[model samples]
Target: MSQPDQAPDQAPDQAFDVIISGGGLVGLTLALALDQGGLKIAVIDRLAAEAVLEESFDGRAAAIGFAAYRMMETLGIAQHLGEVQPIEHILVSDGRIGTPGRQGGPSALTLHFDHRETGSGTEPLGWMIENRRNRLALDIQVATRPGITRFTQDEILDIQVEPGAVRAKLKSGTKITAPLLVGAEGRGSFVRKKAGIRTYGWGYDQTAIVTTVAMEQPHGGVAHEYFLPTGPFAILPLTGNRANIVWSEKTSRAKALLSLSPAALEAELARRFGDFLGKVTLDAPVWSWPLSLELAATWAKPRITLAGDAAHGIHPIAGQGLNLGLKDVAALAETLVEAKALGQDLGDLTVLERYAQWRRTDTMTLAISCDAFVRLFSNDIGPIRALRTLGLGLVDALGPARRFFASHAGGDVGDLPRLLRGESLSPALN
Candidate 1:
């Protein structure tokens, strides 16, 4: 039951070291990270804090990569995340609905990514936590830090990035100024648009149907990515016998499936869900959204920068969206914290470009790979299917290749910031 530090009606003119628009996962994370580094922050969101905690607010769950999970542990938020399921194993295969495998249903060849391969042997590849649970943890953690001032149930009406400062006027008539303004809002970010930063991407022909399912048997902490003719159907384990379903299909097919009765939809899910997890039934409401691939033209514009979905939106074929954003948070927080230690201007483009350059190549590489995966697997073509199936077998058979892919999925690839490496940022200021 964390409360906003400032009530919208009682909010007065104030200034902070940073002002972040959109108090979603990425934004709140940045606020917490900066606050931990001794910087005051203002977090503004359109929805009330309680609304964000509601199950109906967001039905999706995010796969927290091991590296990102370590970051959270360092931030003091991990201990508060209740009821999360670790991803002990991952099985990726290609097949259409009801297709039979060598010993069972699904494809014969599969690429397996085991947690043991990460060199820790006992550490999980990642953790699957509901979006609401994650928000709750972030809300509680933000409340513990007096450096953060959260402005909920409000919108930013105007923004002006002048010399040395960025000023924001909220719809509630509250004004706040900061050296840097960050847009962690989703794909359609007002801050980014207001900054006149253009984006490049196209809407995918697919839509993702997200919901929770109760399996008769336990999921054994295993995650499955089944590639069908339509798209990738992900079965991510949760606490108990429940699993999160992220089913992607053609826009038209998803619309029709969503229009069906609860029982009817369950029947359709069973066709692809298989019996490996035993009988499966819908345990939660169904939610779907059209998929797309979008990347901002630039991440930094004097006094302003973008993070998370505001900067890049990729297909969920791989669950790297939030992990990618968390990386951005780590990078940006480190850059700002170190700059402040050196008495450098946080809003300077030269200072912000450091964050942008560190994330650009990594973000683009993952985005392109996800798009490629969707195109390669979401087809029933003859030669392409055979080649891809063979590719899966090849990757699985190679020891180094399998371990490499496993590490990549765990967010262990690339130049990691201190937080991502499970280290405090204080040393960076040294």
Candidate 2:
């Protein structure tokens, strides 16, 4: 078995085939995947593993697509996801400005994506899971992998890629070397900076205010997206009658709105969200995050590679941020495993390039699509609004077009990795 690569001044430990930085969901999940692939791995993070595992399930939730759910299952983390709320259907509509259809005379056009009708049989397309639970599940899985060593409260200070190995130095005075280094450190990844890899993307002049609310009426397992003038207000179903809300608005407006008194904030929320959920009361602390779309100039350079938020960070308008990262983990792990099976070096440029090629097109497409959606639909103007509303109506009226859109939301688009296809990783031969 491989061992951890120690610093020059420290005692030698087991060197790892892969060294992963960051212990977030994406990072830990990738560590588990690599371990399952028979590669001894070490994962380092700035936060304690217990802290991640013991986090409370609150308003912060993720809309997990079917494919993502399947991957979690294969990783042995899905069963630990607490209180899952299946998304039985999704209702997409525009606010006030109605789309053309039916006898309602240009009322909001509702496009329902029912999983049962889409050849998914009795299974729902996806489920809503609290982010805390997702992180906890990953922590648990990583802890059980014998091939993986996890270090928390340790931050990476720098990375040095040599001819045949990559070295990682930690702020805690620890060091490790591996054939491959995976940067899953998040948007402001230090590994990316240490590698001198430039990034390309811009920030949307918006902030998403997230919180949960107790609604009087049941959501009936249906997620709702209301395209408002400022941005899309997503009401994702949570356990019971509670729904997680991600309301995007102009940064200036968000700042002012966040400063409003509790009573005033409730009033504003009710007005924007309408009476669909009846009386709504905030059930969690409001958290706001600036929206941005960031992509690395390159996913890999020699023995160092980027994954998840380290590679790409996009606006959460489509709720596909985590899913995209999970996709990266699956693809990268599979690429390395396949390379090993062919007696090729896992860190070879050819092998790593395949992984980068697999993700680039899809990543770029989603980034551009999300940016365009945010730009076009977030504005309230005479001609643009009318045109977009009409476009929504036209798309809703077309069945094939609607199915195509639904498939993407369901994570059924494009080539899927073996892990996403529900293939189990083989036991470590070593």
Give per-residue CA lDDT, model 1, range 1-430, as digits (tens): 9877887556776999999999989999999899878899999999988998887777899999998998999998998997689998899998877554432235657888887667466779899999999999999999999999999999899998899899899988889999999999899999999999999999879999999999998889989999888999999999988999999999999999999999999889888876776788988889998999999999999999999999999999989999999999999999999999899999999999999999999999899999999889999999999999999999999989998888777788878898988898755444
How many clashing residue pairs appear in each of the predictions shown? 0, 5
List, residue by residue over 1-430, the lDDT tens digit for candidate 2: 9988665557653478888888888888898787778788888889876665543433478888887778888878987776799988887766543323321111355666777533365668688988887887787677677888887899887777788888777777777888888889999998888889999988888999998889898889988887777888888889988889999998999999999988899887887666667888988888889999899999998888899999999988888898889889989998987787777877778788999999999889888899998888887787987788788888777878877777676666789887887786664532
Worst 10 residues of 1 by lDDT: 98-107
Candidate topping TM-score: 1
Of candidate 2, the 10-residue stretch with the lowest lDDT total is: 97-106
TM-score of candidate 1 versus the correct structure, residues matched by position? 0.95
Spell out the clash pairs found in candidate 2: 3-14, 3-15, 3-16, 4-14, 4-15
